[model samples]
Target chain A: MEGRLARIGLRIWVGGVLLFLFVPIAIICFYAFNSSNIQSWPIQGLSVKWFSVAWHDPQVRAAFVLSLKAGVFATAIALLLGSAAAFGVHRFRFFGREAVSLLLVLPLALPGIITGIALNSAFSFAGIGLSLLTIVIGHATFCIVVVYNNVIARLRRVSGSVYEASADLGAHGFFTFRTVTLPMLSTALISGALLAFALSFDEVIVTTFTAGAQNTLPLWIFGAIRLGQQLPEVNVVVVAVLLLTVIPVIIAVRLTGGGGITRGSAAARSAMDSGSPGA
Target chain B: MTSTVAQGGRPGGEPASSRHAGGVPGGGSARLAAALWRRAWLRATLTLTPPLAWFLVIYLASLVVMLVTAFWSVNPFTNTLVHTWTLSNFRQLFTSTYLIIIGRTVGMAALVTVTDAVLAFPFAYYMARLASNRGRQLLFTAVLLPLWASYIARVYAWIVILQKGGTLSWSFQKLGLGAVNIGYTNTAMWLVFSYIWLPFMIVPVYAALERIPDSLLEASGDLGAHNWRTLRSVLLPLALPGVVAGSIFTFSLTLGDFITPLLVGGANSNFIGNVIYSNLGTAGNLPFAAALAVVPIVIMVFYLLGARLLGAFESL
Candidate 1:
């Protein structure tokens, strides 16, 4: 039928579109190991020396440590503030709570350049030199939204009755939260943490404003890409970051099974079920 | 992080033992337990504290500074800023050269938005409504994959392609078209900007389109409405928030972004981002740069508000 023919054509078009999205990237990643220094054809022999050289590059090494430290601290901050903020806003229906929740998420909607300028100006005025601390602070602002979204959604899913039951059972405020609520929200927290880490590590716009003297991986890579560094070494660094990011992404994906599934069992059930690592 | 997650400290079960151990310190075990409890709460607060303070101190305070600086006059000879306020920064921004820059930024952003939207509709529709789940996942990942790659590296990738006899040129040649000479032209800059930002548009559009209820489309089709009209009236309206969200994200990001233009547009063209970058770098005019930044933020806030208003209309 004509319908079937149309469907087949659609599939090919979709596949082509997807290919366009990823092929150049795949080619670049593949050529990372290609022996040629210039980005060109006639694929030559392969070697791991480029990666080692990239690893040994001092700027890359220092940026790697700085980004790692920033990512960890930022993600940790996002997780705690995000969870507490979520619990507070979600559990208690207070005046302006919805507005506050919206305020928490609005930073994400604003462009990174806007937030960058805001942070940069404030830091400069306060005699606050751009250092590791400033970089972490800049990253944590927008990164809050990631964990906040995850925790808020998870908290919303946990019915008020669940908490009410714990209170009715003569459990203290701390005990009820620790024993009952904590287990349920753990997966959302973990998934959010992974995502926040990835965002913090790769963030450059805000980093540009906040990093007065230090270079994160992206900042170093940004200078090298335009100014011309060892292209192979840059490619090698790109590959390493991709693996580091993608693995956590896959785990986050696995941890985040369904976006919404409060049909039967509690959300806690889904967290426990992902104990078997699919990837 | 995975390795750091401690295991087998206390199981979810064992309520009786948990109660006995709680708040009843007897000996070393009690001391150890108290330390663990104290550390948990302390760690939680410590993790959240510094960043929370930073947002209040830096982000909240900076807006106040921006407002103050907008009012204050700059002393060029003295090399200091005075609190004696004036509106010259705002006044000067309205002149022809600066207005031209704002006009160019908005014009390019509009062109990019329309073209990207047209391309993204078919692409996102396929991914959301037509592709197999496995295929969809692959497609979605492909859309997000570019974001992880260094932004500068991707801009550099275009430098290779946009030149004559490059991959794009080769494709044009094969199509019996003359070699495309887009270098240093607005066309090349637009194309490069489009390529860099298309993924941003597709993801949100896909997210929005996937949320369209299948029954609404099916019902429209059954009632003798065709695919295009069904899409126009049913699917499109439902996906308005996503489109708005995506558009707001793309336009605002592209408007503020100077990287692509700096790399590809050459010295002739500059975006607000480059203006800000230059101010902090070679220009050594931080106040003016800071003042210029307020222009786009104010424009974008209005732009987003307009989109949100349109979103409200779509809901009706």
Candidate 2:
């Protein structure tokens, strides 16, 4: 009877915690349709007007485009460098291999402020002007870790015997890699890339340092809120970004063979492992 | 096989293993590729160079530059960095009010971590052991959905909820409680941090708890151990590593966060991150900010080491 009561209490507690987590998100989604610009207790009225207003805003559009550009470039670079490093580390044993893994994981382990200020000062020191390029570079540093983790984890699951078998059948290294490894790694790569893009898209802390004058979507939202204007419009953009990212996240889940949140956690773990797990 | 290959012919009257020497078109390049691939050390070096170069040149070098820059003072007139090494930055940090900021950040991080651990335990336990498979999937998606949502937006939602006469205060009034004037206070920041990082704590703890075999619990109970005793002996000890693993994320993330405080915190709520950010962005004081950055880095280093000692690295 005591165990049963304890279980019931736990169930209620779990429900309350879940409500706490979702209430904010539900509020954001709901108020996106609020007609009033001034947010207050009990939204004034509901309408789709702010969505149009946000759509017409050039600043929002530009910020969205900039975020996309940065996310794409960062994901591309991370995929290349991260997968290469994963293959190198997985296929070869050499001196300092453990050290290399540790090195790759450090950017994830350190605080974002540390990485942000370091990158910020480095750019200023080198006379390198901060631009989208710099933002991509800052993002790719951690993004590579995401890609590396997913790819390496996947690589670990595959056997080395296949590569040797392909070689024995008169296949060149490149051919074997293209035919055997690439096919096997396709899902991992896709999911990893999507997750990488998602991370870069929402990133703000590091972008605050590396971004000179430009605004990514999150930075734009930050600015809009700081200025305390167009609050409804900001809500619309938040809802839109949430939806945009949610689709890719869902797709990544399907690709990874879902078994709970941990199925898609390879990317989440990678994001956390690189240390700046927060936006 | 060696004799036949050395004779340069096989049973079918074909040359054996001549592909590396010169057999097909572009044989030279193929031979070179085969020879290069055969050398493990050379292949490993070639493979390792690009990514290692990127980490060293871009990541490690920047960190080193920032650390070295922390030792150099800035020119007062032009705001340029001076090459002269000085301990004045460290001295200023130790002597000034920055120590309070450090203490507050660490304290808040600890509070947030502990809150998350407590709040996440029953939920994680339910998800790990009690929920049906379908319920588990729904709960998992429910947990992850917020994570994919924009972090700032979620914080903003809290702003909506915690504002004066907002949802929280209004709800409290309806419940016969007084107003919750938590808006723009450290209390607000704590709530938001705990909310945002709760999933991080839950996932790891759930993972750890799920791996605990039911037989162990059954064995303990069969030995006349009460349910509470079984939990204390079988569950708590096993989940401790996950708790530690999750704490590293919560503690470090809260330690490094500047935006949450800027959004929800009051004037007196300056964290170490806020100071470091201001010093870097507006104050143009690289050395001081770099010195401040060292605080969290040092704290995290020790925290990670402690977690490692607790065998939390596997869960991470």
**What is the C-alpha lDDT profile of model 1 across A29-74, one tens digit per residue?**
6756867676644346777778778888888899899999999998
For every candidate in turn, the CA RMSD to the true structure comes to 7.7, 6.3
Here, model 1's chain A TM-score works out at 0.87
lDDT against the true structure, per candidate, is 0.66, 0.79
Every candidate's DockQ is 0.20, 0.42
lDDT of 2 by residue, A49-127 (tens): 9999999999999999999999999999988888888888988986777677767767755668888999987898898
Expressed as tens digits, the lDDT of each residue in B69-152 for candidate 1 is 666655777756666777787788899988988888888888888777777777878777777767776665565556444455
Q: Single out the weakest 10-residue window by summed lDDT for candidate 1 chain B.
A: B1-10
- Candidate 2 i-RMS: 4.8
- Candidate number of the best TM-score: 2
At residue B69, candidate 1 shows an lDDT of 63
